[model samples]
Target: MNSNLTVMKSFFLLGFPGLSPKYYRPVSALLFFFYLAIAVGNIFILTFVVCEKSLQKPTYLLFCHLALNDLTFGTLTLPKIISKYWFGDGFISFHGCFTQMFVVHYLGSVTSFMLLAMALDRFIAICFPLRYPVLVTNNTITVLCGFAWFIPLPLMLTIVLHTLTLPFCKSNVIAQCYCDHISITSQACGENINIVLVTALCIAMLCLLVPLAFILFSYIFICVVILKMSNATGRMRTFSTCTSQIFITCLFYLPRCFVYVSNTVGFSFSLDVRILIVLLYSLLPAAVNPIIYCFRTQYIKQHLIKKIKTSRFGIQLNLSFL
Candidate 1:
């Protein structure tokens, strides 16, 4: 542990500023319900993808990685927030805060990379259908998946290492429900941290925005290919395949970009609203990701429907015995 960080002892989270006292209990309940939904939804995606041989393709495998990443991120940040709001337990140890920050950002970057890989898979599958089998073989995809999961760790480790070294003897209140690089970096004052901050910002952009740009280009080329196809049904089918991913991309990226940009440009926002927007983008996707995949992707949908029916039949059969 870095000595500077060890001095923090613990950091307090502000929860949602300006929230009414009367609403705390209700809000805590809502957050707990949200957490449960996220757990169940993502668990369904991860378990079904692994168990069902029909969904063992590259795309579904990517979705499994995504689900696992979401599960990790949500488990790290959400339950802690729930505890903070529900019981006024806002203090997190210095080591704990750093760990949370590392995991949250690490998984965020990995998910972006994983999404990029999935986009590439779609691009090959649709634009070069004949070549897709040759080009995007299972072994090729396995390597790409490995890259997605592993690349972010070392790439972002420098920034996290920089963060862990900064002095933090001042007040320990974090103005949000969790620690992120931005949230924690904003706390360092009195020390000459401007250079460190800028370097970290640059690293964050390189990791996040670069992948986003590639995804955009991949989709743009995909659109051009889809537009040239003569068969409307085939075109629609191809486009539909990308739709869920596109929707998820927008949900995951747009708000994060807005938040980061607004913060960078000194765009004034109330603390409460800023945090609210962050949570919407950060956590909402995990909750909705499985739902979107199951409902949008045909293979997963059919298998999910089958599983539901079988379970329902089992319940009825046991009821008859009773």
Candidate 2:
């Protein structure tokens, strides 16, 4: 350890370096739109599910939690990243950086668990239709959702606490827009044994992969159950219900897994390119979940359509009165 290494008190985000200065505004505007969509879309779906009686099923209840988690993640992460490009305001104080990282990773871990809960919800619904009502209830889901959010807090907190011990006297310019655990930890000024990084990755994969395994396990049995359906119509209908979840899960996990595998294999990419890949996995699900999951759900679809028609009719009547 260099005794004279400058102890950094702050960090700067060097976002999308390859993009010319001339394009920062446009890029910022685009990111702003993404942030807006993520926030508005998720909140809209969350409210719809909560207010609409038909959407009070266990699966939709899980969707509500998922939407709330998405909203939390987008608010905590995307705005700061957007500001980096929008105003060149990339500097963040030490405490601020860690706080952001904690919220980002914590909600992300919660999303993984929520997705697993959704998968199991589907599995039980399809596999044991006769027992579905008793097996899956609002109380059961509420507890699972509670565990999803609660379990990750202390775990992520411990990681962040250990991170606070690392000296970051190195360059404060982070390659990515946000303070990710690995991205921040990589900048620490110490022995750099690499063990810390390895340990962090292992922990992340455990949090991410274990529930992913559960989702896969749920689907395996789900597929088997669907195949055993006596009629073609029933099979197609059952399979249709799983399509939205599987699609969103791929959108959420595939880019992440790609990044992990590429890093493991030393597959090199430019900073801008790699950041884009990381952002894809981080933000895409937030944007897609409302559309794919909400729109595809029959009750939500019908309710939204009905709501739109009534609102339009009210406007038309008001115009006539005018």
Candidate 3:
């Protein structure tokens, strides 16, 4: 309903750099398949997490948040990209643009924060095993998750209001698939974009990177603690507890580090490369979070299989009743 009414002029999307239409089509075809994979994969992850009760621990609870954020991240960008390429309409309304900008960044920052929360969760479990139950209880995890979602609201509003205050006289083309802070700010008439830049950087650094650094330090401490243990079983247990977090933290931060550093300093990357990075960074986390969270834990896997078998039995029972 929202996308149909195009009030703006022609959209200006950043096309594939260094490639003509001849090359773009094939590339797009490839990307479309990846996009579909992202959607299906994230949906499966979310569903499995919800269906399997054994995944109700603090770790997988945080992972559900991760999966939810990843779903939003991919949904915000990919479908529009596919539609624009195939259907010849790339325009987005002012409100739609704002919605996209606000939501994507909000969820993105939240997921980053959630990962840090997860790392802390792991830290407590591994570093102070005796205190973990008391420290990271259900109530504590709930409160942390609540703060993770709410703390970034003000920052998101700052960006949103700044974009809305600017006058968009006639220009409506966005260089990227979805409306981001950079593209939206480009259209602002009198708003001091430097303010937006500063605010964005502050939020990004404070929210995304600070937690990431904490996670890194926590991991280092965890490693040191693991090594100090005389027993090999103790060391292996500690490391195993953190394996999922380590994988997830790397997947979440690496691309973000690249994009943030490159964009903040105005280091230009090829459009094709940018697109590729965006696609991978957005989708890979979604694809991996579920697999790592589910497969890494024995309880979850067994519960999942049990549930599937029960569902199959129920289906046969229902047919017999019919």
Candidate 4:
């Protein structure tokens, strides 16, 4: 490993094996639609949350932010992933690799932190109904959302800076479609023990344990509170609103817990399994969030229907004028 050697060219990615060149066109077509679905769904969620005035509560405000984060999270990887498959080239420059790494990590960690904030909001709303308005105001959620985005900036900077310092004179074939930190760092010419350790610790704290603790604690308390209610109707309503969030919390955290805990300890599953698990964490939540909220909260569904009808009516009016 020459200390003076610097990166000369970009690395090409050979995506996880299983499928063959014979299936590339078909698989790439499917991937394009899937990516489009995720992008459109997340964008709709964010746009609806912002445009709807009735959804001005703290919970929904945080939800809007979550939707935005989800869109960014998907965007950070999916565009490049689609390109790789469509163009039959997964190669990315060193700078492109690092940029994707930072964006993905930054968006992902911020989303996790936002979930934590949402959990706290739920806890406060359920436990202290009388003081909910005063306690969890718009300003409060705004501040928390800002904090969530900003909290991980320094850590991400550290990761990026450390990543760039390492020489990449060795192999550059990234095993994954995007510039995954693990795959990229695995190719570094220098010893990545410290960086890997630091990253492991951050993943544990930021991605896995903290969010897990929050979800567990909040749900436990909420369950106890809900169970004590004798009115079946009241219980049903309460459960409906909360069940979606709980489902999302579980979906987001479980695979993350597995990956973070296992990867850090040097026990990793196959690349296919790992990518599938991460994809589950990424795509499922975005897909289900709107459905869950719509079914659980009638207000959200009504709002959506109303918006659609209004748009259709406007279209009809324009057609008549034409």
Give the per-residue lDDT digits (tens) of candidate 3, residues 1-322.
Answer: 2232244434455544455666555766765886676677667767876776656677777777777777777777776766656664567666877888898788878987898899899889888889998898767887899888998889898878865655565467676667778777776554455776777768767878788888889889888989999999878876887787788888888987888789989998776688668767766777677677667766667777887899999999999999
Ranking by TM-score: 2, 1, 4, 3
Please identify model 2 stretches exceeding 4 Å from their true place.
1-6, 317-322
The digit string of per-residue lDDT tens for model 2 on 24-90 reads 8999999899999998999898778778887888888888898898888888888887788888888
TM-score of each: 0.93, 0.94, 0.83, 0.88
The better candidate by lDDT, 1 or 2, is 1
Q: What is the lDDT of residue 105 in candidate 1?
A: 83
Per-residue lDDT tens digits for candidate 1, residues 180-242, read 887887777545578778887787788788999999999999999999999999999889998
- The number of the candidate with the highest TM-score is 2
Candidate 2 has what TM-score? 0.94
Poorly placed runs, candidate 3 (over 4 Å) = 1-11, 15-32, 169-171, 189-191, 261-267, 305-322
Query: CA lDDT of each candidate?
Result: 0.85, 0.84, 0.75, 0.76
**Higher TM-score: candidate 2 or 4?**
2
lDDT of 1 at 99: 86
